[model samples]
Target: MSCKVIDTHSQLAYVVRMIHCVCNNINTAKVDAAAARGAESAACVQRACGTKFNCGQCREDINHRLAAWRALNPMLEAAE
Candidate 1:
């Protein structure tokens, strides 16, 4: 077998899927779009798209991804 190595300490945002909270259609891009449009609340997304959240398996991952994404794009505060 070939050996492969990756640096785990380094963080990255892997937006594997668009986060469409069924209660709201809040996808990954919406957060940025919302911020661009001057929205700071996840609820605003909920109000707009019904992405209020459900099972939450994705919640922790979403939060972490949002943080990772934000770290890379530091000018925007995460709307999570």
Candidate 2:
């Protein structure tokens, strides 16, 4: 039997902190924190982080992050 090798670079890329909002300098950690604080929308997340949309390009990524957060917290979704 042969052993399998993992692509460490790809794994590292996946674990790296991403800048979800380049304009506001907001990263995934900030988005996650906002989601934990009950921010249901991108605007709410930005507001919670003391920022706002400038170019609107980050909306999709922010929404994606919010969706992931919601998926992980089903009880919070039920409460909302």
User: What would the per-residue lDDT of candidate 2 be over residues 1-80, giving only the tens digit for each residue?
Assistant: 99999766743433567999999999988988898888988999899999889998999989988897777678987886
RMSD of each: 6.4, 3.9
Best candidate per lDDT, number?
2
Across 1-80, the per-residue lDDT of candidate 1 in tens digits comes to: 99999787453333434664544456677654554454435555444454565664544544554455556665655443
The residue-level lDDT of candidate 2 at 45 comes to 86
Candidate 1, which segments miss by more than 4 Å at Cα? 1-27, 31-48, 78-80
The C-alpha lDDT values of all candidates are 0.52, 0.85
